[model samples]
Target chain A: MSDHVVSRRRLLRTGLGTIAASTVAGCKVLDGLSAPDHRLRHFMERANDLTMAMQRGVLDRDALAQEFAPVDIRQPQRPNGVTDPQDADYVAHRNARFANYRLEVGGLVHRPLSLSLADLRQMPTRRQITRHDCVEGWSCIAEWAGVPLWHVLDRAMVHTSARYVLFHCFDTIERSLSGAIRYYETIDLVDARHPQTLLAWGMNGAPLPVPNGAPLRVRVERQLGYKMAKYVRAIELVDDFSGIGRGRGGYWEDRGYEWYAGI
Target chain B: MSRNTPPGPLVRRHTRVTRVTHWIWALSLFFLLLTGLQIFNAHPVLYWGDQSGFGFDNTVLRIGAVDDRGVVELFGWRAGGMGVLGYSGGAVRAFPPWATIPSGTDLATGRVIHFFFAWVFVVTLLVWAVGALLSGHLVRDLVMDRHHWRGLARDVRDHVRGRFRHAARYGPLQRLSYGLVLFVLFPMMILTGLAMSPGVNAALPWLSEGLGGRQSARTLHFVLAAGLLGFFVVHMVMVVLAGPLNEMRAIVTGWYRADAQEAGDV
Candidate 1:
């Protein structure tokens, strides 16, 4: 019995030693792999890509964001991240009540039309009461009235080469060493042409407030609130966003947030 | 009393697969909780309905603090009640560093760690569930029979009297708790998690709506996690109470020696 107990203890010790050794070795290997950036984050990025693919492949491309009734509009849309713009151009436009404001729809487009807010409102419009989910774990529902982004794209005559629609906002979210950078966001043609996607100019039965990106804002309803870029200035259609603002795609995307904020 | 009778010979209790899966679950769940708490610290308030934010009065629970500035400032909202809601003090900080992953306030890192282990937790659960079902572990061992209910009541009574029976199979309480964890809590956790995702919501809009709303789903996720924590605490206490060495041996090495009297009955 004594011998048996001794042997069992030895076996357990050997097993524990092997496990400890393997753990140390694994740590070393992981440390080696994590040189450039965090290895875990690298894996997370791949996971994010897989999620995007799964979402696109499995779910209906035209699936609309869930809309609520008028009674369901709970909170007055809370302004998030750079509510007011201090830029000279934006100030001039705001001072004039955006009369001189022209939404330049150029880039990979044929017509390259510069439409005014009145022109956008005059075109075919859609109104929706949808929930806006923030990355910070909050939600708000409000009525939004706008022209379908597809209509604007159609009028601008988006070129066949245009694979993505980029929204360049007038609000300067931050001023960096490089220069004063404005907030920008991008979505593929699939989302841009989604029936619910809108270039919203009205909110809660009233003209869009300055605090709520008056005159224009893009509502990519199927995405998180951040993807709905406020303070709309221009719409540029491009094949790739590699050259745009730090290159990860959108302003927040450049700051380590997922480019496809679908969730 | 047959006190002279020899104790039962050691018998296998847990299978190798069961032991491995159990350890994996234990480890992954620990990480998930820590990481989840870290994520929760970013927005330490939970609400019901379609919307929640600054102007909304739909807060159901909140965790925050007040400072020496005499400002009864709150991080998310004033505590729903005293200690029931969350940690509150002179300087309010909901879920301090030790309680959260990465040991600091980092939502991005928290998310990454949480998601990575989330897949681990999911995959291991699937494998264990499938294995359990195929091996009849779910039916033969975990599931309680009608007779077991009578035994369960007796066992509870005995437990209250500080009497414990050494048995080869799990008692009724164990089976019921295990069943709840396997059939209800884990699945609810996974479903509520998926409901939070906009992509998943797009695929199945009814999921979030059925759960009340996105914010409600988040609230449910936190509540379910707390329920699991309760289970964990009870489970640990039970393990300790049942004789840690014996229970640990049974789970780790699959061998358990039943008391002589119980052994003879079996």
Candidate 2:
């Protein structure tokens, strides 16, 4: 090998060596060893600088997103995040083509009920064209049609004590210690009651594709793309977001991302 | 070696002004990163964070003012920070405190500060760029020769293996990072930033075209900031490996002491 190759090989070996050591150490004392604080701080400082620049001159905060004609919605709207459901229950639901799919709505409601996809589709619906602004710096526009979330809550008779609506997704983002398949997101009642908040079953005027949250998903127009959780299975009414994933209130929340991805 | 030849320790690398501007650049870069992330509270990078509310405008409305929406609305197209979005006065008032642009906080203020500091950054950068041209810093310190390009692999290995600190000057990682910061990041910030100006935007619409439009100028700014954040992380990591105090002192004082003496003079 050339000197460069040898040196690089040595460096890669050393990096792997550190990773191995840290992995072993992680098994023993996973909590105490805060990785050296340097990188995160540096990352933070850079994030701050970018904010100052944009805040100062570059951005138009009120700039409206490009609105599209009503007829231009794309067929087969894309599915975001995890495309395939790995959990056995989700797999079963997918296999059965969601024939038995039902959304259990409970918690802080006077009349909690398990409504099937058929039941959901039979209700009154609304359609809106909006843009999906991804945190990864991409945007796509689509028209979503679905049953208004408030209408569903009304049928279930959500109690006055309820303040937030939590959507339990069918996808297992991370396995919890209790061995229960954990999946869910929460939105406050103000947004929950917005006319645009819907349990969408169709995208671009067609039956929602399997990849694009086939049976059901949410369309929270005001928030960024991630907040519109896909493969939704249940909607739980709650008073607070506490006891939710790290209390930041979403799956990605536990992983150091923000909870409210509102644009 | 001839007796009359100056030792490696005596060589002058970066000038004083160049070093000072670099430090300022570093500090401003860091502050921008933190506040930017916090402001992007689309995901609320932290608790109590909100997207679009931490700017100066939002900060001013928190002083117990009631029914100021009319005044806010009256400010009109040129008021607050950005222009109006046609929301009813109720929605305008309902905007969380963080979204209100202070009376003095307009794109103009941002432009003045950005243009002013940017000129400072640019003038210093120009001097450095000229220095690079004169000294062949781009050819020698930056654009690695084809033969040395192959050495990058081993340099990365040595860097990861902890032998990089022993190498003279910055290692391959440091050199590449510095090169990108100076060449890529700085230029992008300047160009995209200038593209946001209406005068500049009209004169050269294509400049902002890559980033969608002038409205997206902020988004591009944030994207570039993200790149800088990545550079900062790697930069600090290398500094830690190289020994922070010694490295910092060398950059600050323009003199490497320690083994910088005759101990391992190349």
**Interface DockQ per candidate:** 0.40, 0.01
Q: What is the CA-based DockQ of model 2?
A: 0.01
Question: Candidate 1: deviation at residue B236, Å?
Answer: 1.5
Scored by Cα lDDT, where does model 1 land? 0.80
**C-alpha lDDT of candidate 2 relative to the true structure:** 0.58
Candidate of highest lDDT: 1
Model 1 scores a TM of 0.87
TM-score of each: 0.87, 0.45
Interface RMSD of every candidate?
A: 3.7, 16.7
Each candidate's root-mean-square deviation in Å? 4.6, 20.5
Q: What's the distance in Å from true for residue A199, model 2?
A: 0.8
On the 0 to 100 scale, the lDDT of residue A3 in model 2 is 100
Q: Write the per-residue lDDT of candidate 1 for residues B22-110, one digit (tens) a residue.
A: 98998788778877987887778788866785675677777654432221224343333243224434334467555666555566666
In terms of docking quality, model 2 is incorrect
User: How accurate locally is residue B163 in candidate 2, as Cα lDDT from 0 to 100?
Assistant: 59
